[model samples]
Target: MSLSAAITGMGVVICGPKEIPDATGNTLSAISMAAQEAGIDLREIDGLLINQNELIADDHLTLDLSRRGAFGTLKVLYELESKGTTMSVLLKQATEIVNAGEADNVVVVFADAAISPNAPSGAAFASMGGDTGYRGLERAGGMLGAVAAYALIAQHYFVERNADIDDLFAVAQAQRSWAVENPLAWIREPLTREKYDAAPLVAAPLRRLDCARPVSGAAAFIVSKPNSSNSLNPVYVRGMAQRHTMRRRHAPHSPWRPVGASEVFTDALKQARTTADAIDNLQIYDAFTIVPLVMMEELGVVGPGEAGSFIAAGNTRHGGSLPVNTGGGQISGFYLQGATPLIEAVTQLRGQGGNRQIADASTSMVVSVGGRLESVNALVMGVQQ
Candidate 1:
């Protein structure tokens, strides 16, 4: 539905592979950075939303988040953790609160330090309850985490389409090209096919390069009523929708099963009075190399079993008809959960994309596929002229 809110400014702090002092502090600083751009002081923020991902990063403060931050008396405050979809959910909730006049100048922030020196490699997500779900069916799968999970989907997808596995690396290579141009991207080096093959295997089909590089990063966004005097060239929310297509604890019938992606895509675009083809850019929350294809196939952007060929044909690279993850996405860029795509889209729309900016691009469609691909959230945004 059309939202009567606009994003006024945003802030991001990306650190190296090590932990920074009070990772939560990074998030707070990001808020200050964003609020400054919005022409608002810390005391002016009446609402605050923070995505506390305990599973990914143990650095987040619990209820004491607001007390320890640089915010004022918050009329609305919540610390949400809904896997990766938390960013959009926070944004949507902030918009509603602003539009309803419950609060003004709300800021949503997210910070993570999953792959630090303190935490073992992949320790943050190693405890994920594999695809067996709540049923606990004896699949001999336990603590397989996300890489193994997506590998399962890739195995099914590639086998079904008889698609070459090299296409997966092609996506990594394509995203790396964009990352090469992104100053904030962690992996700026080109991902050659040889390097991909040489990379250590995370799962059967996924290599180290195929997975998102977890890093210590934080991002914050400020939103207020549409066209407020304090706002400047604000980004208006065109449409937003979210759907959870999963049982509470049941595993999907198929690994590549379509999660309510089409529903969110259709509803959000319809509310925006636009179509998928009209979208100038796509910012997909891609945690793995195969996610883009799964999303494209599920969204009907390309025919079933055809998304691989589409990307391998350079359809998603810069200067193509459609640029998916033009800012390198989470796979090649640093993984800050849903904040990766959300902030990237905002950066592009603000005409600050630097070398990776898409020319004449005014509209962006961001999709956050969360959980075990169970929750799908789609949002359409347009930059006000």
Candidate 2:
């Protein structure tokens, strides 16, 4: 008894390193924006799902957001932590709960204090998995952090496909070009190929520009029936799919092929009753520059070993065959995981992307990768015809 759902309201607030230090306050403000856009009182929201991994603090925020008034006695409130793909999972879960008549509207919120001074570095993630023997294995090989681990993958991708590192420059610069037009984007300074090439190396093949910057920010949205909202334009959630590789070390390595994206993308498109050609825009998880390069190949946007060449040719840039990460993405934008990308997708669909908006854009695809490519999730979204 799966139910159909649409995004009726969305809110986003991004603070820079010097701006503010309130993650909870930003999240509440975002939630208020969404409630305002949906033209619904806070009391009308019956379901609330917060992605715990993206939050900087306690589980009390959910209650705080819910206690404003009398919620539907059938309210649903919970915290979820699924790494980078938590937002998509929550979307699917909220839709199911709403369809079951247990809740009429579901509010999903995500906020992160990644940019906080005390936050751990990206290198830290690479070690947390050490408990599973990966640390010892990596230590034995002198590979210490996420940058080191992914650098190994990038090296493999280059050798196996005979690709050059310059291709990554193309990917980074393209996203930066889009970021320049995005006011909310963190990295707005022009990122040139020359600048990228000369950037300091974090690992052998991975440079400072290859990784996403952890920034404090918050984003939220409301999921409800299309007819139940006050908004004139609603983006329907056509389809979704999630898959995981479990142990990435055992997975095959390839540039044009992703670990689990093919299966997930295929299932999502099939469920949406659409094809790759129908998508006018793509909001890929660019946690790192290499993520989108491999995803483009996995989604069949380019042939095997053709991603580097395809990107270098500027086929994925704005005003090209396919525009991606129109809002700069995780690398150039704040790293709020999938939450930021999801908000950008909604912006594109709503025609609110003033400068970076795709012309006549109606359909968009969002893909989120987590756990060093071990987890993949995709969503097919479109405006109601």
Candidate 3:
């Protein structure tokens, strides 16, 4: 018999300082508290998974006081330590542990502290790979260079398709408008096309406002048996799929690239037997505005390169036909290591997303990327009746 798991609890800690100033501690505390509030005791948790830019010092020291205090007695089924490792890998590990019955309940936590590398402003982008060499270093380069590459892609998208710059500015304006209503968002101020156009460029064709925030925060969730009484009313993980790029990282340029996000999304829809029209909401990762723009095309929501026009039409706004990033997304919402978007998707499915809630939301989709666009993972979540 196959065992199923569902998220029973969740917690968030953003824009604050804490006793455990390190990212790992803050993340653990956030999810622990959420799980406790949802009725899981810290001592009762059998499995723990943590994701951060750096390893927790406590996890290393033989006589570390914090390690003993935090996870000394628990049977840690899985432990991952890497920076810029995709959230999909983390999610996959946790799911396997739960499926194996190695633990009855699992806690997944992700956090990142304020990261300002010693490298020059644009040069620090290379740090995404942590301290590894070669593949890791290349991955880091991809992270840092993403802004530049995305700008190039966005520019090409517009020029080849005859899209006006105003269309892109309009997307920024619409996202900001939604952020204004979200109190937890890092940037809640209303934005204007004039101001957006005037903002200094981070990269040619990409302004500062068009880029996502570099803020630090943490988020967590508790996964347990689907039938557990502690589970939320609905919001079960129904389908998931992950795909990697066929092209190797060494290849500087390849016309036939691997990691097709569109393919993963379509596979997820197939597993869930859902169609674009059946999806009630979406939470595509917006590391940069261009990411979502590409997703819009791949997801078949709109024609290729037409995401700017589609977004400008107001279909993605709160009251629009399809609501996205109700929590302002990484663009406006606090950047919490990419896990927050998953939390938001769960909130919407449970009908508990206050203020930003979409009316009668029954199903939602989540898309996340890792490395220099080498991997894509998509999940289809819905109310479990």
Candidate 4:
């Protein structure tokens, strides 16, 4: 018999550079408050998970903020590196630890500050690929490389499907409209089709608006076993899958080759015993607009190269047939290294998502990709036992 774990509480703190001088301190406070709100005492927390890039040391989980009294004394069982794909791994680990009786409750926290030293240069263009020194794709500048790759795929997709650029602009404009109502989002200014068209191209065929912004912030959540009478409802980790592909630089010289995303997503759906139609909402990691566009095909949300039409028909916006990225996604929402989508999944399942909450979102799918599209993790989460 497998033991079950559920999320009991959540907290978020998104501060611009001017709001908090110490990013770590703000993150600690956010996690602590979120735990308290969820009715868990700080002392009751048996494990801590931190995913901030700067705070992660070689082998130790530092607790400088705790010594300063932000959170009470507690055991820090495990600490993982902060990467785009760390959140899903942390969630799996936390659940396993709790169900295994190694811990009764676990607190996972993540925070980032734009002012932090070693912040990636050329924030507009970053790559999922770590430093490999590829000829055309620079390591630190891989973000741009990803955009370039996506633009290439998008252009091919459009040409193959005979879709117009106006369809893509409609998706951007709709997400921007949703961003206006989300106070936590970084880019809330309403986007116009004209503005999206006029924006300078970051990479060929990829406009500046198509790329995600680098915003500073933190978010935290508490997980525990379910009790019959708990105040907060539970969201179960129904199924999950992860896969890795050959590094892009090492792959065959065919740009038209199908990436490995479709297999991973399909396996996750099969493991969950659910179909694409069963998913009420989706929280795909959107480092670039094309990321979700690719996912739309890979996840079977639409047929090959049909995502532009799907978006142009207003199918991905709120109240659409398949609502997506309700928290404005990384393109507009706080970018905490891809953890934001996981946090949003929890919030949406708990019915705590304000303003952007889907009408009856009981099940959500979160897909995270990392390392030059080499690694992928997919999770099927739901508000069920």
By lDDT, the best candidate is: 1
Full-model lDDT for every candidate: 0.81, 0.77, 0.66, 0.70
- Candidates arranged by lDDT, highest first: 1, 2, 4, 3
Worst 10 residues of 1 by lDDT: 134-143
Model 1 misplaced regions, further than 4 Å = 1-3, 19-21, 118-121, 129-143, 226-232, 247-253
Candidates ranked, most accurate by TM-score first: 1, 2, 4, 3
Best by TM-score: 1
Candidate 3 Cα outliers beyond 4 Å, as residue runs:
1-3, 16-21, 52-73, 80-85, 115-145, 226-234, 246-259
**Which is better, 1 or 3, measured by TM-score?**
1
lDDT of 1: 0.81
lDDT of 3: 0.66
Task: Write model 2 residue lDDT over 137-188, tens digit each, in one string.
Answer: 8767867656676777677777876776777888888889888888888789
RMSD of 3: 4.5
User: Mind giving the per-residue lDDT tens digits that candidate 4 earns over 349-379?
Assistant: 8887778888778999998877445567888
Across 197-291, the per-residue lDDT of candidate 3 in tens digits comes to 78888767888787776544567777776544564663467777876665553546432222466788788889778877878788867766766
TM-scores for all candidates: the values are: 0.92, 0.89, 0.83, 0.84
**Poorly placed runs, candidate 2 (over 4 Å):** 1-4, 54-74, 117-145, 227-229, 251-257
